[model samples]
Structure formats: structure tokens, C-alpha cells
Target chain A: MFSYCSDPETLSGLTWLSCYLTTGKHTSLYLSFGTVLLLLAITAPIALVFGFGGASAARSRFVPLSWLGKAYIGIVRGVPDIAFFLFFVIALDQAFEYLRHTIKCPDWDQPIRQGNDFVVCAAAKLPLGDAPQWVHETYGFFLAVLTFSIIFGAFAANVLYGAMQAVPRAQVETAEAYGMTHRQAFWRIMVPQMWVYALPGLSNLWMVLIKATPLLFLLGVEDIVYWARELGGTKTPKFTDYPHGDWRMWYFGALLVFYLLFTKVSEVVLGRIMRRLTHGQATMGGEAQRKAAA
Target chain B: MSCWDTVADYALRSVGIGERLLPRSDFTLCQQVTLIGSGMIWNIYFGTIALLSGFFLATALAMAKAAHSPLLRKPAEWFIFVFRGSPLFIQFFFAYFLFLSLKNVFPVFSPLTSAWAGALVVLFFNTSAYSAEIFYGAMQSIPKGDIEAADAYGMSGWPRFRRIIWPTMLRLAWPAYTNEAIFLFHATALVFFSGFPATQQMGDALYYANYFADKTFNPFIPYPILACYFILLTLTVIKLFGIVNQRLNRHLPQLQRGRIRLRPMLVR
Candidate 1:
């Protein structure tokens, strides 16, 4: 990382610290913050889409579709979400392989689940047995994004469902009176109006999503938690130039502070957005604003 | 072995009571159910202790936050903010390492490094912060008329708080507090998976579920069983809270009393 980094034992104090911080592992640790951000970036919109579908389906005229939507929204209510995280990673992987196994190895004789092992044909394996390291990493990231989207989508669905209902019957009726179809009213009238109501819940979900990023380590992604543990463990002088005792507490403390600051900034920004959205609206917030101005 | 015998041998396995070793080879439905149910003991233990103890701290903190004096309020406000702001997983890891270091200086702190004491402390703080916020909101929303009425009757300080303020706050906060209890219980699953090592293979439901998933390579069964146990636990929390809620709101007419609606705030 630096020209001074070539010399090992002679370095001490800040010089040694500077070189150590610039190491490849530490660089990866720094980049892992981007991994967390990337995850949030990709998952948020997808979760919203999933939530929209679920909310709409729940409100559908068809009984079975409504039941399906309600179940999707209600599932996370009872079960711990970490269980879902663990289950879906394996379950989705297996489902993919099983589907591929039937198509790719049509004539293969042995059962897929032989006792305990799920033995898929090599051709059916996700990312392929011979794929590059990056491919495997990307595949895992993709699955994680899907899982987070699914769980958070349920929460968002609950919020959106409520928000949709809170959009006032008269507003939708006015759209119908103007000769708009039900679907048109839903899109043109209801959806636009629901955001103000949904903002609070959606902001909360965002914070939860931010906090849940550490669970990425459990999902087998080499995220910040993994790096913190790896780099912060006892490092003897024999191992490297920058030797230190167990510093995991400091590392985790830094992670904690990082999350705190991120959430604080998000709260401030979201508060501004909420204020902007509430202005000129008919809700309690707008009413208060009106009273204040007068 | 019959299901009854399996239950006898493994029913209390999670607490390190009956079984010395878990079933390895032929994983029967009976073994999964019994062992997993055994593990629920830990979940219930962590959840109950944390919720009960957290309630008192939360109540005190809520009052402190609502107090006009900065001397009483600032520390309480910061404590709640720090605990509420960070992820509980990071909190567990940070606390474990902190306890480990503290144990080296004070041997009495050794117990705090274990999951039973250490993880429990983290959960205690975490739930306290959340529940305190709920309580504070409820305190703020307490009708001014009620306090004024108490003042008119010459009620001041302690008597007014005990008879007029506290009960109403509890009634107002009950539904949200119930949600917090369920969230705290679900959070108990993260104990073993975090920094605290599960001693002697004894762990909560998710630990055994993870074991089965690892061995069987079939997640379809064990995870759902774990979820079912949690669902039952959730329902039990709701029911108990509902009873208390009914009692608190008993003074109100049936039409005016607020029903406990379960809005699952999925994560803390």
C-alpha cells in the first residue's frame, strides 16, 4: 500500500498503523461498506415492487389471490426473520437446482435427496462447478438481495395496504365519478395519494433494512462483520508487521457508531421529505402546519 | 424409540438435562419436535427475564425523558438513543468483547461473558430503549384534563402519578408494548449465532434447527418447526398481554376501549 510498507519490524506507532490500515484486507473491509450500500440500493425498489404486488393482490376481488397476498404479508408477523433468512437461502438454492436437475439431467437415475444430501447433477449446479470466484460471489449476493426483498416486502405490504385504505373513499369515488375505470382510479388517484401516509412506515422499514445488513455475514457474504472479526482477531508479531491483541470490541464499536450515524442522517433526510410531502396535504400534519402559519 | 420415550430422553435437552448427545443418524420427526421444543426453554427464559426486567427500566427511563430537568433527562435520552440506534447484533458482539475484557480485570464479571448473562444484558438494554420510547409517547399523549382533575383534588407528585398517570400510560402503551415483547422474543434466536458461544451444545430453537438443516441438507422441515414454535410463542404473548390490556381498559365503556391490534413491526 505504501513504499514504507516494505520494511516490516522497524516500523512503530502511527507509521505502522498507517501501513496496516492500507493493507489489502483493510481495503476490502472499506469496500464492504459499499457492499452494504449496494445491497440496500438493489433491495429497496425490488421490495417495493413485491410489496405493491402483494398489497394489490390482497385487495383483489378473487378470494384465492387475496388469501395468497394476505399470507405473504402475515407470514413475517409470527416467525423470526432470521429463520426466514436461513431457510430461504437454502430453500431457494435447492428449488433452483431441483428445477434444473429435472430439465438438465432428465435421464439421470438416482434420487436428488439421497437421505440427507441433496445431490444435484453437476450440470444443474448454480453458478456451475467450474465457474469463477466472482460468479459465485455474485450469485450469493443475488440470493441475499432476493431474500431481503421478500422479507422487507412483507413489511412494506402491510404499510402500503394500510396507506391504500387510508386514501379516503371520496377521492376514489371522485375519480369514478369522472368516468375513470377502477384500475385508473387506483393508479391515478389512490397510488399518488398513499405516499404521504406510507412515508412514516416506509422510513421505519428503511432503518430496519439498514440494521439488518449485518445479517449479510450470516448469509455467507464477506461483508463488514466478517472483515471486522477477521481483522480484529489477535494478530501475533510472527504473523505480520502490524501485530495487535484482540481488538474486536473496538471494531464492533466502530461498526455500531457507523450504523448510528447512518441512521441519524437518514432520519434527518426522511424528516425533510416527510415535511415536504405533508405540506398542502389534508392530514393532521398539514392541518398543524396550517394552524401554525395562521 | 417411541415418541413418549424420545420426549423423556430429550425433552429438556436444550438445558443440558436429559440427553448427553443429540440424534445423529436417522432423524425422526419425533426427535426434531422434541429437541426443538426443548430449545424453546431457552427462548422463553431469555424473553421472559428480559421483558420483565426491561419493563421497570423502561418505565423509569420514560419518566426521566419526560422530566423537565436536563440533569435527569440527558443521560436517559442518550442511553435510549444509543441502544435504539445500533443494530442488536452489533450490540451483542460489542458487549461480548467488552465483557470478555472486563472479566480479565474483575473475575466477578466472568459470568457476563456467557450467553445467559451477557446476551440477556444486551437484550435488556435493547428492549428497554424501545419500550421506553413507547412509554414516553404514551406519557406525552396523556390527556391534560386528567392531570388537571388530579391537581384540582389536591393530588400532587407521588399519589397523582401512582393513581392517575401510570395506569393510563400503561393502557395507552399496551398494544405497542405487546409488539415489543414479541420482537424481543424473536431476537433471542440471535444469541448463539452471535459472539456468545453455546456451551455444551445447549442452545435455543434456532440452534437446533440450524443443526438439523446442516446434517439433513433439507431445510424444508426444521426451520418451519422452529417457526411454528415461535408462532405459538407469539400467540401466547399476545393472549397474555390482551388479558392485561382488558383489565387496564376495564374502566372504559366497551365501545370506547381500544382493541389490541397486532401490527407486526418485523425487526427491532
Candidate 2:
């Protein structure tokens, strides 16, 4: 990256360190931080959408729909989420391939599962098996996002369901008294009122989501955890310009600090957002604020 | 193999007792259930021991954080911040490496490299920090009148705390502390995934479940079994904590006693 890095072997001390930090692997490591952020940015809203759908279904008048939604929400509570992360990525991949295999290869007579292997025709493979490297990476990232959405969606559903109930029955009845239908009452009144109650739970869910991002490594994504272990391993002088003993502690320590700051910032921001959301609500927080202003 | 035989062979498999090798090919439902259930032994060990030992430390840390002296309070505050602030995954990795580094300088620290000693220590501290924060919150919420009553009786420091403060704190914090226990049990699954190597193919429930999923290329079965085991374990923790919660709150009038509800905690 620099002219001084032209001869890395001759460099020493600060120069050696600067050149080493600019290596290709280190660049990948730096970019992976963006991957973690992009994941949080993308997954949050999508999970919220899923949560809304699940909560709505669970509250639906129809028995089967409510049962399905309730099951979706309840099943996740019993298990470790890492199991879901490990399970869904592979399961979803196979489900997609199986669908593609049936559609794209109508004449193929082979069973998709031959004992232990999930066999698909060449054309049925995700990214077509011969696609560019970016396609594979994108596919992995997509799987990671979907898995996170599904798991966290259940948690969000639990929170939002509770929040929905917390909204006062009198408020919804007042909307009905004003000649609004049930659906209208829900959209115009309940949804707006529920956010104040949901904010605390949702903020906690956000922190859990941030911490769980590290498990992206288990899903085979070359995330920050992957890179920390990779870049921080011992590199002998015989192979590279800079020789270092095992520095995994330093790399992981940096990651710890990064997460600490991220969560700290998130706590502050979420606290402010909670205050703002509660400003005009018919709750204890809002009541206290009003009294203070008076 | 018969289901009974499979259970006998694999019942203690996680501890390397009966089975030398795990089932390989042509996986059966019986094998999946037995092996995954076997892995629950490790989970139970990690959770129970961590909770038992962490209880005392958590109480002390909570008291320290609530103490008037900055000398006692500052260290407790920072310990809670650092542990609660970072991901446990990073904590396990950092601890494993730190133990490895220490093992080089002092041979006495060598056992800390193994998952049994090292991972247990990490889980103990991690749960202690979480429980300490819960206890601290409960301590702060202890009724002002209760403390005043104790003071009127000439109770000071240790006696007051033992007779008046600690029992009330435990009663208030029981629900949250129960959630922490459940989370800690689930967190045990990450032990093998972290730096601690599962020696001799012996591993926890998720470990065996992952092994089957890899060998069979089927995650649908093994993971559900793991979920079932955990749900049962979670229910058991709730029940045990409820028993203790009853004893603590028994002094109250029957109508005023708070029931133990399993509050869902959002932790990975």
C-alpha cells in the first residue's frame, strides 16, 4: 500500500508493523467488520417484518394460522439459537436445491438424497456450481441473513406479542366507538401505542443480535471471528516479511473492544430512542415527563 | 441395535465411558436420541456447577457494588461491565489463549487449557457477572422501610444484611436469576465451538448433534432432539428455582407471595 512496503523483509519495528497490517488478508479482515454491520443493518428490519407477521398470525381469529404462528414463536424459546443457525443454513440450502432439482431436471430419475448425500443435478446447484466467486460469497451471505432473520424473528414476535397485549383495551375500544372497524382500530391506534412498550424489549433483542453476529463464522461466513483467528496466527520470517508469534489474543482483544464500544453506543442510542418514543404515550414514563415539564 | 442397548452403550458416551466410537452410517432414530441425550450430561455439569459456585460470588459482588466505599464498589462495577459488555464467544477464546500462555510460564496452569477446567472457569465468571448485576438491581430495590426497621433493631452491617437484606434480594431477583440459569445452560453448547477442544470425541449435546448432522447430512432430526433435551432441562431449572423461591418467600402472607413465572430472556 505504501512505497516503503516495497521491501517488507528489510522493514523493522514500526515500518514492519505498518506494512504487515496493510497485507491482503488484513484488508479482508478490515472489510469483514463492514460485513457484520451490513448484517445488522439488513437483518433488523427484515426480522421486524417477520415478527410482525408472526405476531399478527398468532393473534389471528383463525385457529390454524394462530397455531402455526404460536408454534413458530414458542419452538425457538426451548432451544439454543446456535442450533438453529447451524441447522437452517444447511436445511434452507438443501430445500432450495431440491426445489430447483425437481423443476429444472424433470427427466432426472435419481433421488435427491442418496443415503447421506444431498445430491442435485448440476443445473440445480446454487450459483450453478460454475458461477463466479462473488456469487458463492453472496449466496452464503444471503443464507446467513435468512437464518438470522428467522431465529430473531421468533424472539421479536415474543416481545411484540407482549407489547400488543400491553396496549390498553380501552384505547382499542375507543377507536371502535368512533365507528372504526377492528382492522382500522389496530392499524391506527394499537400499533402506534405498542412501540413504547416494545422499545425496552426490542433494545435488548438488538444487543442479542449484535452479540450473535459472531456466530456467523459457524455458518461458514468468513466473518470477523474467522479473520481474527486467521490473521493472528504465527507467521514465520521464512514465509513472510514480518514474523510474529501467536497474536490471536491481540486480535480477539481488539474484537472485544469493538463489540464493547458498539454495544455501549447502542445502549445510549436506544435509551434516547426509548425516551423519544415514550414522550406522548399513556404510560408511566410519559406521565413522569409531563409532570416534570409542568 | 435395540433401543435399550443403544441407551446403555451411549448413556455415558459424552464422558467416554461405554462407547469407544460414535455411530457412523445408516443412522437410526434410536442412536440419534441416545447420543444427543448423552451429551446433555456435559450441559448439566457446566450449568449446575457454574450456578452453584457463582451464587456465592454473585452475592458478594452485588454487595460490593452496593457498598458505600468506592474501594469495594469500583472493582465490582468494572468486573460486571467487562463481562456483561463483551460476547462470551470472545471471552472463551481469549481465556483459552490466556491459559495457554500461562501454561508455558507456570506448569501449574496447564490444566486450565483443557475444556473441563478452562471452560468451567469462564462460565463461572460469566454467569457470576450476570447474576451479580441482577442481584445488585434487586439490592437497590430493597424497601427503604425494611432496612430502617433493621436499623431500629440495632442491626448493623453483616447481621442486618444476613437477616433482612439478603433474603429479600433473593426473593426479588429469583425470576431474573432463573432466566440467567437457563441462558447459561444454553451457552454451554458454545463451549466446544470455542477454543476448548472436545477431547476424544466426547462433547456436549450440540456437539453430538452437529456430528450426526454432518455424517447424515440431515439436521432436521438431531437438532430437534437437542431442543427437546434443553426444554426439559429448562423446565427442571425453573422447578428447582421455584422450590427455593417458595422457601424464601414463605415468610410472607400467602396472598402476598409472588409466583415464579418463567420470564423469557433474550440471550444467545
Candidate 3:
């Protein structure tokens, strides 16, 4: 990246370190941190929307809808989430391609599952078979985001369901007494009140989601964990000018420190948010705040 | 081979006792079930041992965190913070490489490089930190009156703590600790997927599940089977923990006892 980087062999001090750190792979590693942040930014709101739908359905008057929502919430409880990550990426991909295959190739019936392989027609391929490398990578990442949303959505659904239930029945009754419809009561009284109850669980889920970004490497997103392993491995003099024996421990250690700082900052911010949300509310926290202000 | 024969050959396969090679092609449901079920041995082994040992360390750490002196409190607080704040996947990777380096200096540390010992150490410390935090919270919430009553009876220091404080702490912490145990068991699935390599194809249920998914290119069958085994394991943990919870709350009336609710803790 600099003039000194041209001859890495001659360099032996902090200058050499600066050049090595600016290499293409390290630049990718730095950008991958942005990928993690982007994932959190994207996945959080989408998961919350899914959770709202699931939570509402779970509390619906219809039995089948309620059962569907309950099953969605319960499905992720016993199973390891990594299993879901692995299963859904492939299951969803196949399901999409199968749908497209049936639509795109009406009469071309060469068994989609041929004993071991899933072969779709060219038109049915996601991003098509000949698409650019970046397209494939984006498709994989899109699949990963969907998987994370589905699993965490179930967890968020459980929290939101409880929060909705905890939003005092009298408040909803009062809304109805004012001649409001059930939907109006739900939107105006119940939905607004549930946030304080839901914040603790939602903040915890956020922390879990942050920690889970490393699993993106398993889904082949080339996230920070992927880059850490790749760049930290030993590179002999035959391969590169900056040869180093296994520095993976140090790299992973750095990643660990990054997570610790991120989580610590999140905890402080969430604590502030909690205090702000609880002000003048009916909970014990609100009672304490009111007393302190008085 | 017959279903019974498949079970016989692969029953002890995860521990490398039987079945020199895994079935290569034309996979049977019987083979998939038997092999994946066989791999549950490692999962059970890791979870049970780590929880058992982590319980004591967690207790010690909790006590230290609640101590008066900063010397005792700071290390305990920081240890819990670091382990609880980071992903277990990263911890496994970092520990594996750390052990590898340590192995070069002293061959006695070589076993720490493998999944069995190395992964267990990471899981052990990880659970200890989490459980310690839970315990410390419970300790803080112990009713002040209980300690005062013990002191009123001339109880102080060790006797007071043993009779009043510890029991209350355990009773209060049992429900959360049960959730922690379930999470730790689910976490054992990440063992092979992380930096630690499974030797001789000996791995946990997720390992065989991944293998079958790779070979057959059908994730539908194997993944669900693994999920079933885990659900059974989780139910068993709940049952056993419920029994202990009953014992912990035995002194109280039935109405006052806390039930062990299976909350979905997504990660440790």
C-alpha cells in the first residue's frame, strides 16, 4: 500500500508491520467487521417483524393459528441452532430452486433429486449457474440472513408473547370501554406498553445475536472468523514476503477482545435505554425512579 | 447388514470401538439413526463432565465475586465478564491454538489439543463463568432477614453462611442454572465444528449429522434425527434438574416452590 511495501524483505521494523497490515487479505478482514455490523443492523429489525407476527398469531383467537405460532416458538428450543443454520440454508435453497424449476421448466422432468444430487435447469438456478462470484457470495449471505432471522425470530417471539401478556388486562379493557375495537386496543394500549417488559429479553437476544456472527463462517460468508483463520495461518517464505509461524492464537485473541468491548458497550447503552423506558411506568423500576426524582 | 447388526457395529463407533469405516453409499435410515445415536456418547460425555466440574468452580467464583476485598472480587468479575461476553465458538478456536502452542513447550499439555480434553476445558470455563454470574445474582437477592435470623441465634461467618446464605442462594439460582445446563449441552454440538479436529472420525452427534448431510446431500433426514436425540437429552436434563429443584425447595410449601421453566437461551 505504500512505497516501503515494495520490498518487504528489506524491511524489518514497525514499517514492515504497517505494510503487512495493509495487505489485501487484512483489508478484507477489516471490511468483514463491517459485514458483522451490517448483519446485526439488517437482521435485528427483520427478526423483530417476524417476531411480532409470530407473537400476534400465537395469541390469536383461532386455534390453528395459535398452534402454528406456538410450534414455531417451540421448534428452536430443544434443537441446537447450528443444526438449523446448516439445515435451513440447504432446505431453503432447494425449496426455492424446486419452486423455480417447476415454474421455469414445465415439461422437463429429469428428477430434481437424482439419488444424491439436486440438479435444476439453468433458468432455475439461484443467481443462475454462470453469474459473477459476487452474486453467488451475496446469495449465500442472503440465505444466512434469512436463517438467522428465522431462528432468532422464534426466540424473540417468545419474549414478545410474554411481554404482550404482561401488559395489564385492565388497560386493554379500558380501551374497549372507550368504544374502541379489539384491534384498536391491541395497537394503542397493548403494543405500546409491551416494550418495557420486552426490553430485558430483547437486549439479551441482541447480545446472543452479536456472539453468533462468528457462525457466519460456517455458512461460508467469509466473515471475520474466516479471515482470522486464513490470515493467521503460517505463510512460509515460498508463499509470501511476510512469513510468520502460526499467529492464529493472537488473531483469535484480538477477535475475543473486540467482542468483549462490543458487548460491554452494548450493556451500558441498553442499561440507559432501560432506565429511560421505565420512567413513570408501573413497574418497580419506575416506582424507584419516581421516588428518586421526588 | 441387518438393522440389529448395524446397531451392533456402530453403537460404539463414536468412541472408535467398532465399525472401522462409515457406510459410504446407499445410506439406510437404520445406519443414519444408529450412527448418529452412537455419536451422542460424546455429547453426553462432554456435557455431564463439564457441568459436574463447572458447578464447584462456579460456586467458588460466585463467592469470590461477592467478597469484600477488590483483590478477591476483580479477577472473578473479569473472568466471568470475558467468558460471558465472547462467543463460545471463538473461545474454542482460541483455546485450541493456545493449547497447540503449549503442547510444543511441554508434551504433557498435548492432550489439550484434542476435542475431548481441550473442548471440555473451554466448555468448563465457559459454563463456570455463566453459572457464577447467575449464582452471584442469586446471592445478592438472598433475603436479608434470613442472615439476620442466623446471627440472632449467635451464628456468624462460616456457620451463618452454611446454614442460611448458601441454601437460599442455591434455591434461588436452581431455575436459571437449569437453563444454563441445557444451553451448555446444546453448546457441546459446536465442539467439532470449531477449531478442534475430531480424530479417527470420533465426534459428537452434529459431526455425524454433518457427515451424512455431506455424503447423501439430503439434510432432511439426518438433521431431524439429531434434533430428536437432542430433544430427548433436553427432556432428561429438565426431569433430573426438576428433581433437584424439588429437593432444594422442599422446605417451602408447594405453592411457593418455583417450577423449572425451560426458557430458550439461544447462546451462552
| Every model: iRMSD | 0.8, 1.1, 0.9
Candidate 3 segments whose C-alpha is farther than 4 A from its true place: none
Tens-digit per-residue lDDT, B27-139, candidate 2: 99999999999999999999899999999999999999999999999999999888888889989988888898788889999999998889999999999999999999999
Q: Return the clash pairs for model 1, or none.
A: none
DockQ for every prediction shown = 0.84, 0.75, 0.82
For candidate 1, write residues A1-294 as lDDT tens digits: 889889857888898889989998999999999999999999999999999999999998899999999999999998999999999999998999999999999999998889989999999999899999999999999999999999999999999999999999999999999999989999999999899999999999999999999999999999999999999999998887778999999999999999999999999999999998999898899999999999
Per-residue lDDT over B150-254 for candidate 1, one digit per residue giving the tens place of the 0 to 100 score? 999999999999999999999999989999999999999999999999999999999999999999999999999999999999999999999999999999999
Q: How many clashes show up per model?
A: 0, 0, 0
User: Lowest-lDDT window of 10 residues in candidate 3 chain A?
Assistant: A109-118
- Model 1 has an lDDT value of 0.94
Better of 2 and 3 by lDDT: 3
- lDDT tens digits by residue: candidate 3, A112-181: 8898788889999998988999999999999999999998999999999999999999999999999999
Error of 3 at B88 (Å): 0.5
Report the TM-score of candidate 2, chain A only: 0.97
DockQ-wise, the better of 2 and 3 is 3
Give lDDT tens digits, candidate 3, residues B34-85.
Answer: 9999999999999999999999999999999999999999999999999999
Every model's TM-score: 0.99, 0.97, 0.99
How far residue A221's Cα lies from its native spot in candidate 1, in Å, is 0.6
